[model samples]
Target: MKYQARLSLDVLFKFIFKITGLLVLLLLGGILTMLVYNSFSFFLDVKPLDFITGLAWNPTGSSPTFGMLPLILSTTLVTIGAMLLAIPIGIGTATFISEYASPGVKNILKPAIEILAAIPSVVIGFLGIVVLSPGLANLSNLPNGLNALNGAILLAVMALPTIITVAEDAIHAVPKSYKEASYAVGGTKWQTVYKVSIPAAAPGIIAAVMLGVGRAIGETMTVLMATGNASMMPTGFFDSVKTMTATIAIEMGEVPYQTTHYYALYAIATVLFFMTLLANLLGEFFINRFRKYHAA
Candidate 1:
């Protein structure tokens, strides 16, 4: 009876796992169907080449054109800026925590990062507007307080905890023996970390970066509140900017019921959804490759 019960449980577990996977795939499929259904008019009427290559964004005007270039450029620029600002600091913080920090230090630092993650984006936005924007204006030559640099700075702060935590977890997962072996071969502590731990933990670092990217890409409240909310493409770090997520968030409520502009909004959303999907896929692929390289 015990043997049969164990076998039945195992069978049930396998069945549930398969069903769960199918459900996830179906959920994704359903979302795609909805987006496409709503977006059919836009895709059919809007010239793909024009939509992609053109730069105007008069979404609510009389002769509204839906060229996505400005929004796409702004979104990409902010995401890149945030990543550039966050990744190095995050990686360094992770390395220090995993390899050098004492127990007390680690305990303090870890909680600090966790708390950062828990803070609402709106609060961050408010801080940016009230505190950071003034500071940035005093620091820079921009006329208004809001700009890409300010948004990127706040986003980097927002991204820090996830990057640091995930990266630390990755580094910790590297076998201690790898470090020991490096030391046995006359390697210094820093050398061992740079050579063995970082290489071995490369996948996790990439995963962390990708996770941070996703957060930055999907972020709305902070970007909307902090980015000066200009719709034109950005000219420099100090320029007011708009992003795809912000555009959708701001316009979703006010758009015509079923106009081409309406479909265009859905289409832009679809682009973001796919971009995020691609980022995850690429991140997973690189992570697996890193795993195979170091694990084997």
Candidate 2:
């Protein structure tokens, strides 16, 4: 009787999990469908070039411009900036927690780092506006303190915990046997870490950083709050900028649904969706390749 009941519970759990997976897929499809439906009218009027190449974004002006170069440039610049900031710090922090931290220290610090992950995006944005934006704008070279640089820095901070936590987990996942074998061969601790452990963990570290890229690309509130929303292509790091996500958040409220500007936002959204999708795809690809290589 006990065995039969256990089997029934197992079957029930499997059925529930299958249903849950379907629901998640259905939700995603609904979103894609809605975006496509909303974007049809706008696509009919503007050539892809208008959004891709045209300059200026004053959609309400008599000579309205929907060119998205400025927004795209901002997103690219900010993401790159954040990546530059995140990579070294995140990897270093991960290495410390996983490789060097004492148990007691890690117990405290891990939770603290994870806390950054839980903080609301709005709160982060508020910090950028109240603190970072003003401070950055005060730089002698920066035309506006609130520029791409500050927004990127904030985004990097937001992305760090994700990168650190995941990479730390990856480093932790390394087998003790591997370290033992390295020492058996007279490998120094740093040599074991840099060569055997890190190479083994490289795929996972890459996966973690890729996730950060997606997060950076999709971030809206922080970018909106910190980046001075100028719609022009950038000349340097300190230039005022606008990102696709920032543009959507700032303008979606006032723009009518059927106008060219409305569609422009959707188009920008589509571009963002593709950017995130590409990041995920690349991550998956590398992860699979690494898995196969590791297996071999």
Candidate 3:
């Protein structure tokens, strides 16, 4: 009787999990469908080629321009800048916490890093406005600090917690025997960490980077507030520019429903979604390749 009851509970749990997974997939499918439907409506009015290749984005002026090239360029620049700033710092912080920190220091530092993730994006944006922006402006003698660089720096801070946490977990997941064997072969701590542990954990680290990229790319409020909201082509790091997410967020409320501008926002969202999707796919590809190589 006891064994039968246990088996029944196991089946019940499996059914619940299966249902939950299906619900998640359904939710994702619904969002994608909605985005596609609305974006298709926009593309019917605006040529897809014009939307992609246009150089201006003034949708409300007497001569409204709908070029998205500037927005795409800004978003790409910000993501690249954030990754350049965040990746090394995140990976290094993870390495230190995982391999070097004493238990007491580890407990304190890990919590501190994770706490950054809990801070609201608005608060971070405010700090960028009040603190980082002016300071950077003063240092560089730029007209204002609110530019791609400002947004990128804040995004890097936002992305760091995710990167650090996942990377540390990956480092921790490295088998104890591997480390022991490296030591047995008279390998130094640094040598073993670089050659054995890091290589073994490459897949997880790559996943962490991809996750950070998603975080940076999808961020709306921080970029909206920090990036000065200029819709133009950037000439340098200090030049102000608007991102697709920022544009959608800043203009969505004011644009009349069912208007071409309204539909364009949805199209921007579709593009943003696919950009993140492509990043995830590339990450998966790299992860699989690394796994197969390591296995062999």
Candidate 4:
């Protein structure tokens, strides 16, 4: 009787899990459908090539161009810059916490680092505006610090906690037997970490970095508040630029219903969604390669 009851419960739970998964897929499909439906009007008026390749984004002028190259470039620049800045620091911190720290120190440090993720994005943006911006402006001799660099710095800060926490968990999950084998071979702790532990954890670390990239790319408030919101082609990190997310947030409310400009915003979102999806796919590809190589 007890065995039959257990089997029934298992079937029920499986059904619930399948329904939950289906719901998530439906939600994602609904969003994509909405974006495509709304943006259809914009594409009818503008050539897809012209919209993607054009440099201008003037939607209010008499001519009213809808080029998206500038926004795409800005988002790419900020995300790349943030990843470059965050990757080393986050991985190194994770290594330290996982491999070197005493239990007491790890306990305190892990919680402190996790607390950083709890801080509101708006507050981080405010700090960028008041603190980091001025300092960067002074250092670079720029008129103001609100630029791609400032946004990258803030995004890096926001991405750090995620990268560090996930990477630390991956590093920690390395089997004790692996380290023991390294010790038996007279390998130093540092040697084992770089040679064995890091290699073993590569898949997880890659996933963590990709998550950080997603966080950096999808962030709206921080970039909007600190990126100077210039819709020009950026020549360097010092130049002020506007990202796709910022563009959508700023214009979506003010745009007229069903107008070309409004539809263009949806188009931008569609592009952004594909970009994020591509990043995740690439991350998965790399992770699979690493896993296969290690297994071999």
Summarize candidate 3's per-residue lDDT along 1-296 as a digit string, tens digits: 99999999999999999999999999999999999999999999999899988999999999877899999999999999999999999999999999999999999999999788999999999999999999889977987899989999999999999999999999999999999999999999999999999999999999999999999999999999999999999876788879999999999999999989999999999989899999999999999999999999
Global CA lDDT computed for model 3: 0.95
Encode model 4's per-residue lDDT on 1-296: one tens digit a residue: 99999999999999999999999999999999999888788899998899999999999999999999999999999999999999999999999999999999999999999899999999999999999999989988989999999999999999999999999999999999999999999999999999999999999999999999999999999999999999999888999999999999999999999888989999999999999999999999999999999899
Clashing pairs in 4: none
Task: Output the lDDT of residue 189, model 3.
Answer: 98
Supply the global lDDT for candidate 4: 0.96
lDDT score at residue 64, model 2, on the 0-100 scale = 82
Better of 1 and 2 by lDDT: 1
**Higher-ranked by TM-score: 1 or 3:** 3
* TM-score per candidate, chains pooled: 0.96, 0.94, 0.98, 0.99
Question: What is the alpha-carbon lDDT of model 2 when measured against the actual structure?
Answer: 0.87
Q: 1-296, model 1: which lDDT tens digit per residue? A: 99999999999999999999999999999999998787777989898778877798887777887889989888888888999999999999999999999999999999989999999999999999999998888778666679888889889989999999999999999988899999999999999999999998999999999999999999999999988888887887788898999989999899878888888999898889999999999999999998788668
Arranged by TM-score with the best first, the candidates are 4, 3, 1, 2
Residue 80, model 4: Cα distance from true site in angstroms: 0.8
Report residue 285 deviation for candidate 2 (angstroms).
1.1
Off by over 4 Å in 1: none
TM-score, structure 3 vs. true: 0.98
Candidate of highest lDDT: 4
Per model, state how many residue pairs clash: 0, 2, 0, 0
- Residue ranges of candidate 4 with Cα displaced over 4 Å: none
- Pick by TM-score: 1 or 2, better one: 1
lDDT at position 61, candidate 2: 85
- Residue runs of model 2 more than 4 Å from their true location after superposition: none
Q: Which residue window of length 10 is worst by lDDT in model 2? A: 135-144
Model 1: which residue pairs collide? none
